[model samples]
Target: MQKTRPILAWETLLDIARTDAPAPLRERVEHALRRAIDDGHLVPGSALPPSRTLAENLGVSRWVITEAYGQLVAEGVLDARAGSVTRVAAPTLSERMPPPHPPSDHPAPTATPVDARFDLRPGLPDLRATPRARWGSAVKAALSSIADRDLAAAHPGGYAPARQAVSDYLGRSRHVATTADRVVITHGASDGMSILARELRRQGHRAILVEDPSWPRLRDIAQTHGLRTIPIPVDDDGIDVEALAAASVRTGARVALLTPAHQFPVGAALSPARREQVIAWAHAVDGLIIEDDYDAEFRYDRRPIAALQRLAPDRVALIGSLSKSVSPALGLGWMVLPHGLNPEHSPAMPSLIDQAALAHFLVRGDLERHLRAARSRFRRRRAALLDALRAELPDASISGIAAGMHLLLELPAGADAAELARRGRDHGLALTPLRRYEDVSRRPEALVLGYGNLDDTLVSAATAALATLLRARSETPVASVRSERTLTG
Candidate 1:
């Protein structure tokens, strides 16, 4: 007896293909299909539509659909036979291993929300302000400028024009004196760090120095590459250079990863003196400094601090990305390496098409124009957020607003930030506690408020709701304890 094929709905498949994803259309479609199968949205026996039908429904070409299906089939995630249905393969076909699960005693924590009215989580940019039209124009121009052969693959280092464009942008904007040969195009700052960590490990480095209360992912990334991390505390003037030097010498940690331009979450620019001291420390230990220059462009006050690489380009690997300046959806970033580090040793480079488009975006001044407009809008949003917080929560202390998309809000003593964040969730408001960023040690209760993606209305509403919650909680809290350490915001 013949069995019937389980038809997959085109709409269902399209739902997973996010429009904001930086991947190309074909890649996005393929990724959605793989995700669907992995998540059981499409079972092993489920059959995808023919290429022509899916293309017609998606408004893409038959070739695109065919390519996506072909790639999946090659990857063993799907199975296709001549004159038959293309069905999701059995789990056995996919050799990919599931990610290692955390121990039962220590569960992994997720910050994503199911259905929230206001999401004030950190590390996201203003998606509404993304320059869609300008980016499309840049991509079109890039396509016109590239030869057919260029579509095959880019050089391991990067596409030449894009590298040159990135180098020029760094020199012009960040005051980093670098040539194209020193620039390595990467997927993003994370990928560049992973590469650097692996290289450090290969070079017999045992440990890396990172900031305490930093993005948890940084430590995870370092550990994933078989390197131990030594968390150095940060203060208002940025990383405690004296402690960093001490930690480096004591632990023999030769690699230090820092966000000196505008420190993540805390938003403290490294003081001029501290910058010099840090460089001298790097020289003293014969170490490497990985500077993450994310979000250095949108400084509302005065000119943004120059890249630390400007001072000691020979000892710093400067990483920056359009993820903050342009849009995170466009996962394009670059690294300017010191003279000694091998530029040809990148783990993976971005696609030629993306690199070319970013090159055009930079060369045509589209990035500069977009930054100017985005800065104006973000400045207004930041002001609105600060105003709302001040008016609604008079007793609440706020800091870390000098730059970046997030700020730190301190509740009165004896208030539980986690409980407050939970109360916020009840009101359909998503929030994160500053405690989440502390990997090695515990800090005082504080909330990290991200204002970049929130409009004035949402920010006001969310902050007001939080204020009410905090007022109720503060009224009943009587227990108090003294804290010995304070993380500078």
Candidate 2:
């Protein structure tokens, strides 16, 4: 059966109306009506009053009523039948926001062990070799000492002691300038980025500049704040600062997001000259820089490079996490903000209850012990990868291997790294394409191989698998004949 109700003409007209109602009353009613409609408080086909009579009922003028109602008709929210008789229009389904994509139900599952398969998933620390036994002891110790009220609810920022520890650690390791007061505990780097993005938006800066071939999760976090995202290109030295300056000037980019320590997946450390140029450019442009120090603790070659934050703390926001050092299970992350750009919530940024109860257990005691073990394990895995890669594919060169758990193998010219990645999976191996990081149309040939979770035996197998790929590509006369080159030694 069809149903009908009264008109919204008068109601909507009052909204956009140049009403004679007091300005305050006009705004209050307008907001209330809009919110009611949005929240489903005012359903479709709801009634409105007669113009002259309702104006009198509300102690208002007919002119006010006419103007308000006229607006509703103009907006198509009301349908006029005869003179002065109007009805509410049927609601449109498009008025509501679309539902979100479903959450990935699980981690992209890794297949069971296959002979000689090298696993190169990015950003994973070798947990199997982490000193789990020691971590267990720390967990037990932390649990035994915890007070009853500690578990009820935490300080919205984070545990104070953990903040103190992180402050101390960052000072020593990342070259960040801060005290415990400057530290805010967070779920991880992702959480801190979200909070910073929102706070930046509040400060009247909305867009973020990210590396085209950078971490994907950052795109999601920046977008959450209704901020626009811009992609900056990267070359051997790091983000093309000149190009970034051009983008900023052209687009009025207010902030630049950087993973300058060692770029994600690509593993190229930002050169000293480029780092200084970036800092200077940001200052000259009055732009804020976000420095993500993802894997600074595990560089196997040379004394560690100084973090970009240390060079310019006033303009730089530093983010680091325990997932790559201690355990992802903890989900613990921290940040160092320039004294005054401080976050109101410690690490609570965009998430409520970001981690499970067990996270605190990893923080209070096991952290120091786990970091020591993780550093050692990644060092071995990094070295083993380089050694095996050289022996197996002596001709298949690698980059970004001087530091971090992953390295990039620039494929022979004209080969599609993205397709090769899929091919690796087909052969019961897991690998990633360098193209995933590229933001623009690129035809480069490279693959990012992570060795964090792979064992020495599997490392050998994976290297052999990759070597076969290189050999087969070389055999094809149509494939562009280019020498296998190591971009990062």
Best-fitting candidate, scored by lDDT: 1
lDDT score, candidate 2, position 284: 94
For each candidate, give its TM-score against the true structure: 0.77, 0.69
| lDDT values for all models | 0.80, 0.69
**What TM-score does model 2 achieve against the real structure?**
0.69
Runs with alpha carbons beyond 4 Å of true place in candidate 2: 1-117, 147-154, 344-369, 441-443, 470-489
Ten-residue segment with the worst summed lDDT in candidate 1?
Answer: 478-487
Q: How accurate locally is residue 36 in candidate 2, as Cα lDDT from 0 to 100?
A: 53
RMSD of 2: 13.5
lDDT string for model 2 (1-489, tens) is 114435353444333334555574434444444555566555566566676765676576777666666766677665556653455556667755454643676655644233425667777777676656665665565566556676675566565555666676667766778887777777789888888998988888868888878888887789988778888887667888988898898888868999887888667778888899999988998888998887877766665777798888888988888778766876668788885696567433422233322344344545556666666777787777778876865655566747778877777766777667667765656777877766673736777787777776677777777667656655653234343444442
**Tens-digit per-residue lDDT, 227-273, candidate 1:** 99998888778889988888887888989989988787666778888
